[model samples]
Target: MLKVQEIRELIKLIDESHIDEFSYETNGTKVSMKKNGGQIITETPTETKPATPQKPQPVQEEELKPQEEVVEKKDQETAAEQSSNYDQEITSPMVGTFYQSPSPDQGAYVQVGDQVKQDSVVCIVEAMKLFNEIEAEVSGEVVEILVKDGELVEYGQPMFRVKTV
Candidate 1:
C-alpha cells in the first residue's frame, strides 16, 4: 500500500509531466487520480477485496519474440524513415496502451488527412486502467497514424506524424 505522502509526491510528478492521470493498486488498496482544474483529485474507496492466488502461466517464446522484434523494428524505422523537416510527431506522453478512440465501438479520434489544431485531442493513452486524453501539440494535417490501436506504447513513442499546415 502507498502512503499519503508518497501519493502526493507521485501526483506532483504527474502534474509536472505530460501524463494526464495515474492509477495504482496493491495490497487490497486502490488509488486513482486525475488532473482536474489544475489540481489533483484523488479517489480512494474503502471497499477492498481479498487477494487470490493464481498459478503463473508460461509465455510462449515464439509469441514473445515476434512482438519484441516488431516493436523494436517499428521504433527504429519510425525514427529514421519518414519524418521530414516540415513534419512534426505527436508522441506518447507516458508509457501506456495506445488507443485511437475513447471506446472500442467509437470511431477514431483522428485519421490520416485530418486537420488538427494545437491542443486537439488526438488519442488516448491508458496507464493502469486510467485513460488519458492526449492532445496534438502542433497544428497540422495528420499525414500518418504511427501506432495501431491497443498497442503498448513507451514514453515518447510517436503516435502520429503531421505536416504543418
Candidate 2:
C-alpha cells in the first residue's frame, strides 16, 4: 500500500499529465484513477479470484457527493440548451486555459453576433504552456460565449455557440 503522501503525489501527477487512466498495484492492493471531463475518480477494487469476491462494499453517502455534482452540472447545461436549442457550439478540443484574444493588448478574437466561417480563428487554448489557436469548424453567427476569458476549460467544453445561417 502506498503512503498517503505518495498517493497524493500520484494524484497530482495525473492532474498535470495528459494520460487519462493510471493504476498502481502492489501486494494484492490496487488503486485505479480515471479522469472524466475535468473530474478525477479514484477506485480501489480488491481481487478475490481465490474466494468468491466479497460482495463489493457499499459506498458511503459522503462518497456520493461528487456524482451529485456531475448530475447537477448536466442539468445546468440542459437549462442552457433550453434557452436556445438552435445554438450550435464549438467546444474546446483540449483541456486548458481559454484565451479570447491573442494577447492582453488585443481585443477578443470573436464576439457574439459575429459572422464566422469554417476556417475562422476564434480563440486560443493554452495547455502545458503552449498556446494553441482554436478555429471554428462550422460556419455561423456567434450566438453566445459559454466560457469566460482566461477560464480553465476541460476537453470538449463549449467555448462558443453559433447560430447557423
Candidate 3:
C-alpha cells in the first residue's frame, strides 16, 4: 500500500507531465488516477469478499453532504455565467504564473474593453522559468480579465473572456 505522501508526490509528478492516466496494482491492492477536464480523479478499490444481500435503507444525514456540495458548485457556476457576457475566451495553455505585462515596469498588454485581433498577444504565462506569450485566438473585445497579475493559473484555465466579433 502506498503512503499518503507517496500518493501526493505521484499525483504532482503526473500533473506536471502530459500523461493522462496511470494505474498500479500489487498484492491485491490497486491504485488508479486519471485526468478529466483538467481535474485529477483517484480511485483505490479494495478487494473484499462478497456479502449476503440485505434490505436497503434510507441514506443517513452524513451521506447528504456530498450532494449539497454538488448543488453549491452548480449555483456558483450559474452565477458566473450570468455575470459574464462573453462569446469566447483566452485560456492558459499551461500551469504557470499569469503576467499582464511583459515586465514589472511595463504597462499591461491589454485591458478590459480593448479590441484584439486573432494574433494579438494579450498576456504571458510563465512556467518553469519560461515566459510564454498567450495570444487571442479570435478577434474580439476583452470583456473580462479572469486572473490577476502574478496569480498562479492552472492548465486550461480561462485567463480572459472576450466578446467575439
Candidate 4:
C-alpha cells in the first residue's frame, strides 16, 4: 500500500518537473501517471474494503466448477507459450511525433526485415519543433515496426523490434 507521504512526494514531483509521465512498480503494485494538456491522470491498484459482519448466505459450489475449469485451461495455454522468441525492443529516446522518413516523399529509413547497423538512422522523432533522428542502438535486422508514421509517441515507448545479428 502507498503511504500518504509517498503520494504527496509524487504529486510534488509532477508539479515541479517538466516531465509529462511517470511510472513506478514495486512488488505487485504498479502506478502510472500522465500529464496531458494540463490534466494529471493517475492509475493505481484498486483498494478493496474489508467485508463487514453480516448474515451468512448459503453458497452454491456447482456454478463455480465451470469457471474454475476455464481458468485452468487458460493458465495452461499461457504456460505453454511462455518460451516464445524474445526480440530486442527499440524504445523511443524522447517524447515526440514519430516519422518514418526524412521527408514526406522520401522512402522510410527502415522497414521490416531490413538490416541496420548500430549507428543506422531508424526513424525521426520530432520534439518541441526540433526534428531529431533516431538511430538503432544495436546492429540487427528489423523484425517489427511498431509505430505508424507521424504518430505521437511517449518517451520510452517501444517503436520497433530488432532481432540482433
Candidate 5:
C-alpha cells in the first residue's frame, strides 16, 4: 500500500515525465492514472482481498541462472541477425513524438540515400514540450527511414537504417 504522500509524489513525477499512463498493483491494492491533455486523472485506489490464501512459490537461484543466460543468448543472436541486415541503425534515445524536420515549414534533416556523418542531426524527439535533436551516431548513408514524421516513438525504437561507409 502506498501512502498519500507517496502517491502525490508519484503523480507529480508522472506529470513531469513523458509517461502518459501509469498503473501500480501491490498486496491487492491497485492505483491507475492517465493523462488527458495537461490534466492528470487518477483513479480511486481499489483494494480487494483474495478469496483463498495462496502458498508462495519457492525459487532456486540455480534454476533461474540457466534460463536467464539462455534468454540473453537468444536476444544477442536476434540482435546480431537484425544488425547484420543493416550496418547501423539510428534509434530514438527517448520516448517522444518523432519529427523529421525542425518545424512544419522546414525540410527534413535526412532521407533515404542521404549521407550522414557522426553527430549529424537526423531528427527531433519532442518530450515534455522539449524538442531534442537526435543525432546519427555512425557515419553512413541512410538506406531506409524506418519511422514517419510526427509519429510517436518509443525509447530505443529504430528510426533509420544506415549503411556505414
Candidate 6:
C-alpha cells in the first residue's frame, strides 16, 4: 500500500506538472490515475492472470446476443444509481487549499447534515495567496463533505454532496 505522504507528493507533482494522466508500476503493483472533467479516477490491474483451458467448440451467435443485452442493462442501472444518490455536487471552482473554517481558530463554515441556503458560505479555498469563500449554489442539506480542512484541492473536484430541497 502507498503511504499518505507518497500520495500527497503524487498530487503535488500532478498539479505542478499539469498532467491529466499518470501511471506508476513498482514491485509488481501498477496504478493508473487520471483526471477527467475534475473527477479523479484510479484503476489498478492485478499482476496475476488466470490459467484456463479453452474448448474448441464455437459459441452460438444468438445465445451470445442475450448476454450482451444483459450486460448493457446492468451498466445502465449502475450509472443511474450513481447520479440519483447525490442531487447536486458542489465542485471546486479552482485549484487551491481547502479550508473548512474562516481561520485555524474558528469553527468550520459548515458541517455534515447542516442545512444551507443558496449563496451560503460553505468553505474557503486559498489560491495564489488569496482566500476565496465558496458558497452553495443551491438550497439543500449537505449530505457529505468530500475534502478535509487544509487539504489541497483540484479544480472541478467534488467538494460537497448536497441533497436538493
**Which residue ranges in model 2 land beyond 4 Å of their true spot?**
1-85
The residue pairs found clashing in candidate 4 are none
* TM-score per candidate: 0.53, 0.57, 0.60, 0.53, 0.51, 0.52
**Cα lDDT tens digits for candidate 4, 1-165:** 654336446756874789888998887777677767353332121113223452131123356778889999998896456324325777786678999999999999999999998778899899779787787878888877889999999867889888786
Task: Give candidate 2's total backbone clashes.
Answer: 0
lDDT, candidate 3, 1-41, per-residue tens: 65433554676788688888999887787767777734323
Per-residue C-alpha lDDT of model 5 across residues 10-103, encoded as one tens digit per residue: 7668768888889999989887877663432322211122223332212354578799999999999987876765798888766789999999
Candidate 1 TM-score, C-alpha based: 0.53
Residues 1-165 of candidate 2 have per-residue lDDT tens digits of: 554336546767886899789988998878788877343232322322323444333344448779989999999998776557445788886778999999999999999889999889899899789787888878999988889998999866888888888
Pairs of colliding residues, candidate 2: none
Q: Candidate 1: minimum summed lDDT over ten consecutive residues — where? A: 42-51
The TM-score of candidate 3 is 0.60
What do the candidate models score in CA lDDT, each in turn? 0.77, 0.78, 0.78, 0.74, 0.79, 0.77
Model 6, range 24-124, lDDT digits (tens) per residue? Answer: 88877665666572443322111132223422222344577799899999989975876676699887867899999998999998998999897799998
Which sections of candidate 6 miss by over 4 Å?
1-84
Q: Model 3 clash tally?
A: 0
lDDT, residue 86, model 2: 45
* Per-candidate clashes, comma-separated: 0, 0, 0, 0, 0, 0
Question: Highest TM-score, which number?
Answer: 3
Better of 1 and 5 by TM-score: 1
Query: How many backbone overlaps does candidate 6 show?
Result: 0
